[model samples]
Target: MGQIDGWEINCDMGEGFGRWKMGPDEELMKHVDVANVACGFHAGDPSTMVRTVRLAKQHGIRVGAHPGMPDLLGFGRRRMAIAPEDMYAAVLYQVGALSGILAAEGMPLNHVKPHGELYFFVQRDAAIRDAVLRAVRTFNVPIYGLPTPQMVADCERVGVELIPEFYTDIDYDSRGALVPVAESVPVSPQMIRDRILMIAITGQARSATGTTVDIPLGMGGFSICIHSDLPGALENAKAARAAVNEVKKGIRISIY
Candidate 1:
C-alpha cells in the first residue's frame, strides 16, 4: 500500500522509562499526526507504552511502533554489531508488545519505525535492512525510514511501502547523511521553522555546510519527523504544524 497523501509530522513518543521522563509529549501531541511510540527494548516500560498509546488516542493520532536496540541506559543510540536474526526477533517482540497494547485500546498499529541507531542502520547494513523488511512483511504496514538508494530498491523488491522520512529537527551533513542526534546542539526556533518551510516547499534541506541537499520527499505519501527529545520540542512541533498547514493551503493538496 502507498502512504497517505499530503505532508505529515510523526513524533517520537513513550520515551520515558519508569519514573524518569523525556520530552513534552502531552502538549506536543496536539501538533502531530502520528506518534512513533517506544517499545520496551529502547526507553519505554509497559506502563509508559500504555499511557503513551492512550495519549495518542486522545489526540486522534495514528499509533506506530518505535522499536530500538535493547539499550535503555544508552537510549539505544549506540550502534552495535547485531545478527540479522537478532534484529528480526527484537523487532518482532517489540512490535508485538506495542500491537497488543494498541489492540487492547481498540486501535490499530499504524506503522513500524525503527528507532535510534537501528533507523540509520538500514543505510549501513544490508542484513539489518532485510531484517526490518521481513518484519514489515509480517506486520503488513508501512515503514518509516530514510530514502537511501539501497533501502528504496529493497522496499520495492520486498513490496513494503516505505514512508521517506525527512527529519525537520535533525542535522544532515553535506552528503545528506544524518548527524547523530547525540551530538546535536540546541537550535533556534526560527531556524527550525525556516527549515520546515523550505523543505515543505522545495523538498530540500540545508546541509551543515549551508548547501541545499535534495531529499526524496515526494508530492504525497511522504512524512517529516520531529524528534521529541530535541530542546524546545514542543516549539519545534508548533513550527512544523504551522509550516504543514501553510504547505497544505499553498497548493491544491492531492490526498491518498
Candidate 2:
C-alpha cells in the first residue's frame, strides 16, 4: 500500500466492450501482478468490468481503476479540453464504479491510473492533476504514473503514494518522450526482455537520440508496464516476467 519493495508487472486489461474485445486479457492475466481495469468510460461495460476483476482474483493479482476521458468512440485516446471540475467528476465516477465492483469480489481497489490521453493531460496541467489527485485521495490508494518533477511534487503535497512506472514494450524518442506503443507492429520478445533488464539494473535507458533518461524507481522499486494490445503481447509479458526474476537474483543482462 504505502511503499512496497521491489518491482511489479502491471498490464492493462478488460479493455473490451460488450462481446467485443481488444487483447488476450484472460491469457495475459497469468503474467502480470496487477490489472488496470477499465471502468466503463474507455472500453468496459459493467459486465465486462466484473469479468475483468474476477479474472484478477482468479490469478490472485491486485486490481486498480483505470479512468479515462469520456471518449469511448476514440477508445479514450483522443485528447480533449476538460475543465478541472469535469476531470474530478470523471475520475471519481470511473474509480468509484470499479471500487464497487472490487467490493463485490472482496478485493480492494489497489490503485488508480488515468488512461490514454487523460494520463498526459494530468501531467501537463496542474489544475487537472490536482483534481484527479483529490478524487484519488478519497480512496486513499496509491497512483501508478510517471514521476515527472511536478507529478512527484504534487503527490507528496497531497499525501498520496506515487508508484512510478517504466514500459518494457515501448521506447523513448530523441527528446526523451515515450514513443507511443504501436499495437499493429510486432516486437520480439527477446528485445522486450533486454529492455526490462537494461532499465532494472541501471535505472536508466537510452532514447532514440541516445539521450540517457533516468527512470525514477522510488524506494528501490518500480511498476513495470506492458501493454496488452501490442502484437506478441503474451510473449512480451512472459519475457518481461522472466527478466524481472533474473534481476531478483542479482543478475544484470545489459542490452549494451
Candidate 3:
C-alpha cells in the first residue's frame, strides 16, 4: 500500500484468554481500520484469535498479527531478558501461527506489530531489533511500532515497511517512550482525542511533563493506537476515529 495521506485507526484486539475477555472489541472494531489480533502469546487463545479475525472480516477491517514475549502471566507487559535468537524464533512462531489462521479464513496478513514489552524492547536494543525486523521481513508485510531512530535504521536495513504509531490511551515521557502505566494518570476521551489531533496536525505529542516531543509521521502517514484494555474503550475509539476523520475531511487526507 502507498503512503496514506490520511491517518489509520488501529486497535489492539483479541486480547482475552479462554472464557475471560478484555475490551469492547466488537464496538471498537466498527471504528478502527486495523485490528491487531493477539497471537496466543500474551492473552489470546486459538478460539479468541479466530473469533477476532472473523469479527474484523465481518466489519471490513484489516487484520494484523500482534506478537509478544511469552509472558502470559504478566500479560506480555513485563520486560524480560531473552536472547536475540530466542526473540527471533518467538516472533516467527507467533506470526506464522496467525498467518495460517488468516489463510484458512481466506484473509491475507496485513501487517505485524509487537505487543507490550517486545515493542518497547526493540526500540533500545539493536540485536533484538534486528532479530525482530528479520522475522517480520520474512512475512513480507509492514511492521507497526513507535518510530525510534534505531527501529527506523533496522527497518531500512531489512527492507520492510515500518508504520509509526501513537498511543492515545497512555502517557509518554520527554524521550517519546511510554510512561509506565502504573505511574501515569488517567486520561479521558476528550484528552485522547486532543492527543490524536496534535499528532495528525502538528506532528508532535505533548509529553506528560508538558514537553512537546517530536513525533515523525513517516511517509506512510501514521497510526493511532487505542488499547482495548482501557476502561470505556468504546468511547475512546469513537472519539479517536472522529478526530482522524474530521482532520482528513478538512485537509484532504486519504486513509489506506
Writing each residue's lDDT as its tens digit, candidate 1 over 1-256 gives 3245558889999999999899999998999999999998879999999999999999998999999999998899998899999899999999999999999999999899999999988789998899888987788898998888898899999988888888877788888888888765567667777887777656788887779898876555788789888788998898788778878878543211
Look at candidate 3 and tell me the lDDT of residue 218.
Answer: 69
> Residue 154 deviation, candidate 2, in Å?
0.7
lDDT of 2: 0.84
Please write out the lDDT profile of model 3 over residues 1-256, one tens digit for every residue. 3133348888999999999999999888889999999999998989999999999999988999999989889999898999999999999999999999999999999899999888878887899999999999999998998777777877988998888888888898997788766667788888877887787667778898999898776666777888899787898999898888778778644221
Q: After superposition, how far is residue 180 of candidate 1 from its true place, in Å?
A: 1.1
For candidate 2, the TM-score is 0.94
Which ranges of candidate 3 are over 4 A from the true structure?
1-5, 251-256
For residue 100, give model 2's deviation from the true position in Å: 0.4
Model 1 global lDDT (CA atoms, 0 to 1): 0.86
Error of 1 at 197 (Å): 1.4
- Residue 82 error for model 3, in Å? 0.8
**Poorly placed runs, candidate 1 (over 4 Å):** 1-3, 251-256
**What's every prediction's RMSD, in angstroms?**
3.4, 1.9, 3.3
